[model samples]
Target: MTNPCASEIFKELSKGSRNLTDLTGLGGIDIFPGMLDLFEQSGKFDYKIKNGNIDPRLGGKTDIINGVLVITLSNDYLSKATSLSVSRTIIHETIHTYLHKQLSYYTRTDLNTFELLDKYFKTKYPLKQDYQHATMSHFLLGMAVSLYNWHKNFGPTGGTLGFDYYYKLSFAGLIKDGTSELLDEAEELIPPGSSWSDIDKIIQNEATGNYESKGEKCK
Candidate 1:
């Protein structure tokens, strides 16, 4: 139950935190894993770069991890995340710190990784192009990541009543995470009861562009 990301705890351990060169350089953790504070709309987490949960100064900065990050995420996160989500986010940001420590440019290529998605969906839209120009695919991927994790955990037993409840609950996060306004508009475009099909379509469009980029485009 220790708040490892707290500055008070950090100051006792390290003399002071250093500025990371970029997001990729951050790695290591001072905070105890499996720890959490009550999640809140106004609440934020702080991590020291050398070791902690989240850097408090990462506010307003999308690509760099030089300063601390105060991640005041949307309320949408509540539905999809359990303690597990926090763990994953912690590891994710940690990787950014580690890589950014040695190099420039935090790893962003994977942020848009849409490999083999087109063949799965098969669409006419340029999902990859849209992904590059707009953050649409990023939203989709983030939603997919959470969904996939949830499914991986409960998907085997046809899911429990509790699991199903959680899935429906997270539906809002699916929309809110990054795809809200876009999802709302797109959901309207889609007919009810075929949401999965529509989601596939978007993936297909994106995958096609991805293959094209490799010069080995899929048919």
Candidate 2:
């Protein structure tokens, strides 16, 4: 099947700017049912209204009672936001969910080596600062997300990535603190003899080292 977001391609029409404070066309992002499916697949995001008022924060929310998603917004946002806002919102939420799912995977690995690491090393050598470790999965997943965002906002080369509402990350060089060679670095980590099948499996799968998922001990 075609990509779910395919129909909502921004190329079909121009998306004038829309701000979060101004809530018009905000509901437009929900036009693609799959987009909703994508979001739902991530966690528990429910449509809710209570006490006679719509929640106004786009800040992320989690359903503590059941472990799900619940982002709140106003009717004005649903009615007045533009396509750009909707697209960015979907992309942003999708990233959050993807990370959650992968962490779940790591939490399940039962390798003994992983158990040993968790028992003896992980806690002892815990993060000392910015000196942190990244799973291959996290790195590549980030690369993919960054690249897709680049495409969504910037489109193809000679295309635009602006939102007039909020900044959509564009080319890497635009960042104030880091180099833009991230994509290149992630791609280079591919195993030398790996095939497309190798690519199909989790990118973070390493020959050694166990991973933690959902705060559970895993390998």
Candidate 3:
């Protein structure tokens, strides 16, 4: 099978953002509003989405080049990943973009909150790397909500599984590189004495599973 063209990938990104917007209400949990704003006002925000060569291990990445915001996806990975997985990647990178932008322009109150959280995490997990990922950890529930809604509308599973499934999926890439400590923190948000081992297995399988097998494709 041929890899999806850049246009097709862009279309999927657009649709995914719209799905998140529909699911995330104002003042809701997560950074839904801020993340969605990047797409909703792309011109004003001055960001672009494109497909490019990147590490296969990374689904997507957001960065600034020549003062222009850019979100790049792994062309090689996209050819194999499912549409559902693609949606997850888009959501992940969009949040990164939102956080990146926050660094430059934010209200004092917002900046203070971020600093407080950053300082708290640093103190708690001195080895933690990537402040953005650390910050993203605090918003896992919001990410889970967005992913659950996206799957419900576009996933092959019809998103019929329990909320815990998506909640675990939200922890996909955050459980590594010293961010594991945050996973321990997330456990508090769930039931008492839940087994992350089982949830981790489900997330692992889903990450490598074929979208076509689930009645969806990355076309």
Candidate 4:
């Protein structure tokens, strides 16, 4: 059974996903169609969420067992994290669920271009330790955009937060052994004239700072 706090977090995530799907144009490009798919066909996804003991440093884990997708949010982390941070972790894990579903069930007749690209990357870099993160790095902009929209519509208000902040948050759990190189590759997507060093500082500060203390608690 989902804990009360986990249920609330999932509710917020659903609202954010629905908001994205209901919008049009989306700044001239569909930023998060995969998220739309995950929510729209949620009944078919066999996904579940629960709070549990996990690594202290981790916010959540997406696990596949017996054909089920289980997202476990660290109870300790959730207790301390703000609503926005918990929301980001949910989004990150759900993206992993989406990729697993897409790649595992893909067929040539029904495959989308994104799935094709996912397949190509998996094949090309089969031995990468962070294959999922590597594939997801190519699509961080979409995650960033979705996060910003979610925050704007359903999260805390004020303080001049923008896409750059959420964009850095989107990178929280994605920087790892096989996927760290993609961060350098993604520098092109950063704001014009902004160096990776600038982004690195933002990511570092977010990791170490107590900014979450200032935001609404997930409870």
| Residue range 1-219, candidate 1, lDDT tens digits | 133322232232122111111112113312221111111100123334332233332211123445753223212222223332332233233322322322324522221222323322254334432222122222322222333333334233322323222222222322332333334423443335646454443332222333312111111
Instruction: Rank by lDDT, highest first.
Output: 4, 3, 2, 1
Predicted structure 4: clash tally: 0
For lDDT, the strongest prediction is 4
Candidate 4 Cα deviation (angstroms), residue 175: 2.1
Candidate 4: where are CA atoms >4 Å away?
A: 1-3, 15-17, 21-44, 106-110, 113-124, 127-129, 158-160, 178-188, 193-214
Per-residue lDDT of model 4, residues 63-112, tens digit only: 88787889898887777776667767777787777666766645222256
What are the lDDT figures for the candidates, one per model?
0.28, 0.28, 0.59, 0.62
All candidates: TM-score: 0.26, 0.29, 0.68, 0.73
- Superposition TM-score, candidate 2 onto the true structure: 0.29
> Of models 2 and 4, which has the larger TM-score?
4
Tens-place lDDT digits, model 2, residues 1-219: 022222243222112222112222233322333222322333232322111124443211212225553333233333333333333333343333343333344432223323433432355334211111222222332323332343344443312322311221211111111222233223444446643333422211211112411111110
All predictions: root-mean-square deviation over Cα?
17.4, 17.9, 5.1, 4.1
Worst 10 contiguous positions by lDDT, candidate 3:
35-44
State the TM-score for model 3: 0.68
Sum up the clashes in candidate 2. 17
Root-mean-square deviation of candidate 4: 4.1
Over 1-219, each residue of candidate 3 has an lDDT whose tens digit, in order, gives 134543454454455455654553323344545544444432234467788888776767787899877888878667666665666667677666666566664422256435745674567555333556666666776677776776776566876766666777676666445333334555555545666665556554554555323324465
